[model samples]
Target: MGLFVHGDVGTAASYEPPYTLSSGESVRGGERRLWDNGAACGRRYRLRCLSGSNRPCKDGTVDVTVVDYCRKSPCPSTILLSTSAFSAISKSPSAKINAEYIQ
Candidate 1:
């Protein structure tokens, strides 16, 4: 299992402003609710919508619970993936992501 991050922005409850996270930021918050570097297959991440709104889960920040690894580009090191992480993030359904990892 590898740690995946967000790469792009989209239209979702988490994608709103104020809570929206820019690139190059860790996806961790309080204990128990944290983003790790390892996850299993067919897992689900309990994330918080960065936008923190009641809107639809189009795109936004999330707290992943580590499900499966993504076999895609710029994923292994991505800190903020595209809307695709919705599955892993448990907000949206699925997404086609392109993200950059934080150093």
Candidate 2:
């Protein structure tokens, strides 16, 4: 999974439909696969960090709502977890870590 600061336009989930995140709730942006052509918007997912080299993984899951679409020419990851969400599952928020996510 990848990580992005909430509202950071560069890698933000800026897709349409006007979404807002609940207080204290984790959120993410998904690529085409998870986006499902916008159907994945508002979907919920539970993500667990599997492994990474930079002391990345933590033990437990982070539940996240899909708030936006992640569109990049060469997608970096399936999902881009908000910084807070990434921190919940990994120690290194900037490092890309393998994650197991489910609906």
Best by TM-score: 2
Residue-level lDDT of model 1, residues 1-103, one tens digit each, is 2444663322221121233233322232111212334423223333333332333333433444332233334233323333444444434433323322222
Question: Candidate 2, clashing residue pairs?
Answer: none
RMSD of each: 13.6, 8.5
Give the lowest summed-lDDT range of ten residues in model 1.
Answer: 25-34
Candidate 2: what lDDT?
A: 0.64
The residue-level lDDT of candidate 1 at 20 comes to: 27
Cα misplacement distance, residue 72 of candidate 1 (Å) = 0.7
Please give, for residues 1-103, the per-residue lDDT of candidate 2 as tens digits.
4442232111222122233676444454555766787788777877777777766778887778887666566666777777777788778757777767767
